[model samples]
Target: MKSFSDKLLWGIIVLLAAAMAITAAVKLSPLLNPPQDISLPLNAACDLHQGPCTTSLPGGGRLEFSLEPRPIPVLRPLRLQVRATGIKADSVEVDFAGVDMKMAFNRPRLVSGKEGLFTGEATLPVCVRNKMAWQATVLVEADGQRIAVPFRFETKR
Candidate 1:
């Protein structure tokens, strides 16, 4: 037979143990399943230049590009508008694998209630023509993670 005092003490002990268990479980939950890496699909629209063409991305969180009019119009340059969200990267590099154009930019650190927007311009190789459809892939890296997004366009003479 247990005394009343013993029962009271046991009840308190049980509650304390339960609390400790809950705390431990929550602390270890994140470790058990860490965040997985993910890549988003590329978002872009194609436009042809009558005199001067421009592609605009809203929310300042998108990339916009344009090409200059050419006499031969064989190859044209690509202008890029890049935006960063929830990141604090010191630098960023844009590489056009399909074409010979490559560029790098210094991105401003991410701030509270505001995302960093980067805009740059580059010229495509002169050999690129409308007959050959090309793919331009953009790689954005921040916080030790890299994301690749692709855009495609054809030049029409």
Candidate 2:
């Protein structure tokens, strides 16, 4: 009787462990195979508040990013635009993150336009501080490669 009970306990333990492993794998698969970010090597700096800024692509193209309504404001729907001159951009997404603080995941995919142009709308969350720093990363997928273009700017509340 004792031996039988021990075997049953072991079986239950094994099942629970297997279940946990499967759950972890499912949750972490995206992190393991996330889109390639090519922003580290090429730290392209741009002031989005100003009209438009252009950055050179890795292969051999130029990417221009612009924000509508000049002087970005928080809690407003701002029009974001991207135009890729040289690269064949299939998909484009903008990821916003607070540079000085940890905020929620805010990434919006842009609608592909004619040729290499992509447009989207995004709103920045309000912060407790008077001024906040943000980093907006433009993700471009072209020729089976995901390139990340990061830009930094500050906004006041």
TM-scores for all candidates: the values are: 0.42, 0.79
20-134, model 1: which lDDT tens digit per residue? 9999989976544323243445544444343322223222344333334433144344445555554453334444434333322212222222255555555544433445444
Worst 10 residues of 1 by lDDT: 103-112
* Best-fitting candidate, scored by TM-score: 2
Put down candidate 2 lDDT per residue, 1-157, tens digits, no spaces. 5798899999999999999999999997664445675763434456778678888887789898887767899999989999999888899888888898988778889999997889999998999999999888888888888888888888898
lDDT of each: 0.47, 0.84
- Measured by lDDT, the strongest candidate is 2
Candidate 2, residue 82: CA error in Å? Answer: 0.4
